[model samples]
Target chain A: MSVEHVVSFDRRSFMKVATGVITGVIAATSPLAALVPSRAWAVDLGALTDAQGAALLAMIRTIAPHDALDSAAYALVVAALDKDAAASAAVKSDLLTGITTLGVGFAQSPESARIAQLKAIESSAFFQGVRVKTLLVLYNNPIAFAHFGYEGEAFSKGGYLFRGFNDLKWLPEVPLADSGPMPV
Target chain B: MAQFDLNDDSVAVIIGSGAGGGTMAHELTRRGIKVVLLEAGGRLTPADFSQDPGAAFGQLTWLDPRTQSGTWDAAKTSPNMPAWHCKTLGGTTVHWTAATPRLQRYEMEARSTYGDVPGTSLVDWPIDHSELKRWYVLAEKRMGVTRRHGMPGMPACNNFKVMYAGARKIGYKRVHTNYLAINTKARDGRGGCIQQGFCSQGCKTAAKWSTLYTEIPRAEATGHLDLRTRSFATRIEHDVAGRANAVIYRDSQGNEQRQKARLVCVAGNAIETARLLLLSDSARFPKGLANGSDQVGRNYCHHLTSFIWGVFDQPVYAWRGATLAGVVEDENIHNPTRGFVGGYHLELVALDLPTLPLVGMPYGWGRGFTDLIDNYRNLAGMLINGEDMPQANNRITLSSTGKDANGLPVAHIHCDDHPNDIALRNHARQQGTKMYEAIGARQVVTSPGSVATHQMGTARMSKDPSQGVTNPYGRSHEVPNLFMSDGSVLSTPGAANPTLTIVSLALRQAEHITKEMAAGRV
Candidate 1:
């Protein structure tokens, strides 16, 4: 369940990191960063600074808090936002301004204080955009899918026909004849 | 494989290729008539369909920008998307649940059965039930529908088992896996369903009947159909004699092309069908083609729909079977004692884990929301497919400002739920809660209605030309050679899903067109 054990970073992605400074920010100071493995897979950030990325991750985790989930799942949202922000100047400015509005040390603040700050600006476009993107990316990730016991894509495994499609043992068995007459 | 000349005036031009248009193309081509079928979207085979819900939605959905103005929940939640229908070659049939319930006699005669319902434009179908019943038999046979014509019903899955037991526990008798146009055993040259559970994602196994793999291909095999994919029809032009003679469309390369026709049949579902007709306005027919009565885009109806979920203590594995394979049909019968003019069916429904939070549940975040996702394996779901009253004001009109990629005015949909629709939904929700509670449900949650998938009654059929856009056979009252072959011709939004009726009407329309062509009338 640790973030270090879940995320695997290849050499190409490690080299793609904009600077060693951002990697140091994630690995050294961030509370969640302390759990990073020795080969720490610092995510590539094109439009967001290391502090902005950390705040965004904290904000996402606060929005969709699952105590059982790893920080790697929340980091995926920041990665996606950074990618969007890199593609659009409007998105970069929005994220920068939105993070600035959250005030400094937002990611370092206690959970209750962070929650109160988020509540005050819950109606803002920035919060709504980040929330929708987090929901889309986080729950659809393999980490969330595995944690929730969701068997994704049955067709590749020959579907659920023989794999307990009708194998509910808790309920009384429904008779096949209960389907009634065939149209003649 | 057939390629008709663009100037060929001997071919019938059919617009959209879902159940209605696809079936029409097959029937006409088989009868030795040449056809030029125009579909706005590109074609995709079962092999191209994705198991991922998000990817499949982008691939198959009609993502064209549409405007919405209404008091319905969709107007607020999905302001840009008022209706949900496919734009692929098979149209919405590619995304349909394949439920094939026949319309009851009373549902067709809404005027006689629900007398004097104020603020509604209720009208009896010009074609009687007995007449349409004949074609329904043919449509069912053609589609190899399970639970009909000696075909056995699909095996009960965990979702269906939960629904059947709960429905029976609540004193309902006529509950079973629904009559679906999917195979239980291999028939009609298609494989049996392996219960893959993504029935809406274009039916990867081809076990579910879709025109993409069935009628359209069959029409191509006959060598009498010129199937044009990615051809967006802009307008229908007519001759001086007031007969539809050509269709102007944008081709795949964004080039404008006009294909001449002997006649035209429009089957672009309800919204697009109405919009296309309105877009065809000419000096000769000022308001729009075949719109002499100004009834072309009036009386839009999408059945009152909502999802009701029951949370159980144990796993139901609702997403293991066909997406919608169970039904409770007893409530589908009309009885004034139920505090509604019409009735509704409670059909089993299940959304995948990724989709459940987005649409199945009320919008929320944090622990309260994550708790529901944690119980995703224990949720049993049902959908209310109830009759929604048709208001004359609930209609499709051309947006004055918004234009599509092709520079045509986008359709603006306006709908405000009638009181009867609200009542039917409330009653259905209560009954659904009781059924689940009878079988030991810990919690019941009801969701707001999603976008209209069962679109109908925009361009309706009527005995009086002033009351409707088409005649009993779906032929336009103003133009002799123009016909509407889709759900747009439905006189009322019956409790049943509109696909079966849409197919039946297409079958009947094809027969009528063949006869009319032989007699030299059209």
Candidate 2:
């Protein structure tokens, strides 16, 4: 379930119930909704605080290990989580709780233990959600796409006609045995 | 179209304007019939579609909170999103990979051919392949399906190339860039596919045959179709004589409006169609409308699917022309020697880096998960499209307590993998692994499988009313004016893709309805 779900399910009863049927309601969009990122357009969002952001970023790097990725790419994921937490205080609390518990002193832990710490929490809802979002946000970044040898320039740049559309070097040839027209 | 008469009962109200309803709108309106096409999502142009897979998923997906049960991985992997269908105006026509393979003859008569496997609800279609052949021709020609009637096939992409090489190595023939509805050389006024690679996530160009641009637009030009986007159908009301006469739906503004109908066509795909039937419970029809047979929400079939990715030593650049370009049809037949009654097709499929982790392995996280995404360009994929046996227990039922954004009870999709389905999937996955391994793939990853594509056979067609909901003509057995225009009318989930067959059935139904109306059959 999503963070909004966590908020609604947990907080539905706390709101003043309509005593004797007369009713009213109020609501607004979350804070940190601003922070529109680049053309790939992962929303630029703010975590509640810096340490929260740091803890989340540390968690993200562990999910997708990349020496090639800039520090900004990790920030892309942190921005999303921060926004997610901003929307739901419960998700925020969950993030902090997970970081503190899953981290096992992440700052001081050896590299192997850090990896092991992340692996322990991989199945948890927070880790899974963060991991899913990280994969989405990071790959959408054009810089990340470039590093991964994926160009979004297929049809836009001359339709892959002159480019390597038919190029498959490693595999064997599949000859056109039935060169005649396909049957209707 | 302007606000249609709320009281006018002449208009044929279609409850979903994607493949079936959109095509019906075009076909019926041209033949001088008024249609009120109700789509449960907004009408979006290509400008609204995002190229990013994640964004596109949010922009296009239904994302409704439907409870899932039984042992299908879809319940565990994508719990909220049971079926991967778009709620938008074009329906899943927007989300299709456009593989338009005709159903093989043996597939239509599964009961006679495959025989009865234990723990399955296998049955024959009311109509045979020969009965559907002429209609299939009309559908193929109209959609400009490649490799048919001299319309050329889509150019081979890197993924298709690798798939072909693998097929050749495995001593299998009949490998080709598919007879997809996507264009090679611009026909039907739509542009040829330049293939920006997000075929599963709405087509960027007007190249793919989504009704948003193709049939719906043409229907709009005839001035007989009132395409109401985001109008969710709640119930099918009928006359005391048991003829469907109206559709009660919540309009975009959340006001419930009952559109009086001369004929009510339920084409909201299988899940919604079945759910709507169950929700429309009445005093006369306690079970549901046109559900006297108790088969309105039974015999659900999602193609037994598996995604296998091959990580090669060199760059395959699988993300090229189309999302899916090639098919190995040699295995799309029943060879009982393979330990499975039915067979499956192995098609070349490619997922972007973002999609690979979430769907390719939704629950995994480790060195291996990172490695899969790290070598995205070097990966080639094969998706097994197997013929799933329809189980009476696997169905779309209205939840006892759970409700939707609207106060109506949500549709809970319950599916347990039949043993036949498991056998077919396992066999196909092994074959895919071997195919990849033969082509010098470093490692092969078999996904625990993912969300469904073709959802079919909830309200199936059969010779006996006790067995199925619709007859050979897709008309309801109980209600004369009600028709099932989507995959819900399908008796079986054939090995190949189901869209072409769905389109063919719609065309044939249109002709039958037209002729019956002329003769005053009702």
Evaluate all candidate structures by whole-model CA lDDT and list the values in order. 0.86, 0.79
Q: Model 1's A-chain: what TM-score?
A: 0.78
RMSD of each: 3.7, 8.2
**Candidate 1 at residue B480, lDDT?**
92
lDDT by residue (A1-184, candidate 1, tens digit) is 1233234344435455562113322334444444445335545567777778888988887888887666676777888888788899998898888988788898999878888898888989999899888867777756567667778788888888888888898877666665533212
Clashing pairs in 2: A35-A44
Number of the predicted model whose TM-score against the real structure is largest: 1
| Model 2 vs. true fold: TM | 0.91
The fnat scores of all predictions, in order, read: 0.58, 0.41
Error of 1 at A177 (Å): 3.2
Model 1 bad stretches (over 4 Å): A1-14, A19-42, A110-115, A180-184
lDDT per residue as tens, model 1, B1-522 = 999899999999999999999999999999999999999999898889988787898899999998888887678656767788999999999989999999999999999999999999999999989999999999999999888998888788888888888898989998888999998888889988888899877798888999999999999999999999999999999999999999999999999999999999999999999999999999998988999898988999989888899999999989998888889999988898888899999999998877787667766676776777778889999999999998899999999878999889999999998998999999999999999999999988888888788889888999999999999999999899999999999999889999999999999999999999999999
**CA lDDT for candidate 2:** 0.79
